[model samples]
Target: MRHLTQNWHVNILGFVLFLFTAVLLLIADNLSISYKEALTFYDEKNLLHYLSNLSVYFLGQSNIALRFPFILFYVLSVILMYKMTADYFKYESDRLISVLIFMFLPGIIGASLLVNNSIIVIFCTILYLYYYRTYNRHNYVLLFIFVFLDNSFAILFLALFFYAMKNRQNQLFIISLILFGLSMYIFGFDTFGKPKSHILDTFAIYASIFSPLLFLYFFYSMYRIGVKGKRSIYWYVSMTAFLFSFLLSFRQKIYIEDFAPFVVVTVPLMMKLFFHSLRVRLPRFRDKHYKVAALTLFLLFVNVGVILFNKPIYLMLKQSDDHFAYNYHFADEIAQLLQKSNIYTVTSNDYKLLKRLEFYGIHTDKKSTNFISIKPLNVYDKKFQIDYFNTNILNIYYVNLKK
Candidate 1:
């Protein structure tokens, strides 16, 4: 009874801490539209139109409702992450260390706070890994269903990699072949249709830059343990993936939610093995002080690096206007202008603007002229919506209402 009471107290405390973190994160700037917008843009577009529609269903067409569903998903993801850390590193000490590592990691924390696709990817990846580690079976099939939510070829590839990790060779091979075919079709590779650029070229470029490094690291770690047939396969998969990402990363807009998990899981395992090697040669390399110093230095460098790279980007993005609000303001101004102008369909090269306007319940069939910039505008042609503050755009400016 006493132990149960203590456990309850601990659990309650944990929940309180979790809620505090989540609430602060939830309040951060909402620069991007939730997955709800993407679905609404492409699909039948009912029940899931705005973030508010997730909780309190206000049937009014003004595009506002309760936001609890999105908030709930974010909170649930953080709680599951806590549970995963507790399970994977079962020892009390290890669990504490793992949780600290997760809390400090820029990618993990930044994704948790946003309504972006990355959080969905994080949830799916964590759940899949947890189930795989726990059941050691094709339990990943259950997890793969959620992967479609992320729209990432890299994640689909990672899912196939997970399937291949099992001892069942026949099952792994069949799954891999299916994934290969599916990837080709969905990603605009060969056979599905011709992409603007060759998929093989992208694969080759990423592979050349990152694969050799990943392979060398994998080989060095594995060689220490006598690399045999099945164990060696892991490196091959890692390299193949690294190659795919090298091309994908160049696009700059590709979200990390798509591939961060692969690095998070794989890197830790590699480091663990590296540390094990260091331990074996501890006496020759250094005494206790040196070993501690090395580990501390390595961790410090990683912590600093993660912060330097991730925080500024997340902050800048978080400070921007939420996609819905930005478009909403723009549309209201346009609607006022439309009252005076005879124009209806605006030709816009900006895909995001088109999507954003649609998300805010503004109707326009943004047609684009062949010229990328400044072509003759017909009096019948509609005005192109432009945000005045965004500096990259020079030729476009918002004509004020008084004018």
Candidate 2:
């Protein structure tokens, strides 16, 4: 009966993951190409761009095509999160909570649909953790292998070096130290334009990334580990990145990506600390801990809902640009609208917008007669609807100069 019950729990976990992936596909279908995505798709030749090009080539250029790889990264990250939880957390319930929280994290959800390296970075970092803990001797092989993967891995190497030093794992220390130096040499840190302080902005971004309530507990979890709890390799990695990112924020605005991936995998750590706290207390005193957990989960679920149903957020915004996802709108819709008119060739004043349109069968021909211009008209275009309500996202004009 016990074995059967364990299998039932495993089935529940598998079903939940399937549902999550389905939700991810739905969100990706709704997303339009952003200006940053335009830059990534057309200008850059990084790993992500190369994979995206391949996807779009095989699948045709659609939002789902552009985003499918990132969503796959999301799936891998979720599975790895579960694996990490299985290691760090003893109980089935604790492991389940950790995986669910990670899947619902606002940052993770957004990264999965956008043209960014965050999801992949998260996937790689967690994979490294699973390897580091599971395989003792061969771990540094992966450690050294990561030097060429990403500039962000420099932060990972730094954290690993610190962990090695603390635990006196000489092999891990030397390899991570060498890898850290190599990564810095190849992808030098760019702290330029970071002279100004944006500590408050950094805090706000983190809050939004994890949701305000969960981030609060994440911070507390780190402090709790430092003050009293026994720390593990994962804790060391997470704490190092958390401190480094914030320390840099005191000087200049830090790229949250460099640090966030390292810290997010610590959701298991945060859950472990939470459950430990609740269980250690007397039953009567545990009410506060339960309340905190309930509130945090509520916020996390709300954050996920807001992201999945973000089209409706346009209705609340005074200016379309003021909307949080404003960057990912306009281009695909406008391209489709123009293609219907058999207008395949045009030049836009917005260079980025023009490039994005190219992905959807529109091409830029400079010195051509057709000119595309945009204005901030609040009138809804009957052509482009986000869900059932059409958005007045942009007013585009196609000026014809044919004599």
TM-score of 2: 0.93
Q: How close is every model to the real structure, measured as TM-score? A: 0.52, 0.93
Q: TM-score for model 1? A: 0.52
Report lDDT (Cα) of residue 291, candidate 2.
84
For candidate 2, give the lDDT.
Answer: 0.81
Tell me the number of clashing residue pairs for each predicted model: 3, 0
Worst 10 residues of 1 by lDDT: 392-401
Among all candidates shown, the one with the greatest TM-score: 2
Q: Which candidate is the best by lDDT?
A: 2
lDDT tens digits, residues 128-200, model 2? 7787666654366666767776788898888878888988989878888888999999998756463777788
lDDT of each residue in 142-256, candidate 1, tens digit only? 4345433434544455446554665456676566566655655655331222234454544433222223334345445545533533343333334444445555544433333
Candidate 1 deviant stretches above 4 angstroms: 1-20, 23-26, 29-75, 81-90, 113-115, 143-168, 186-240, 247-257, 267-403
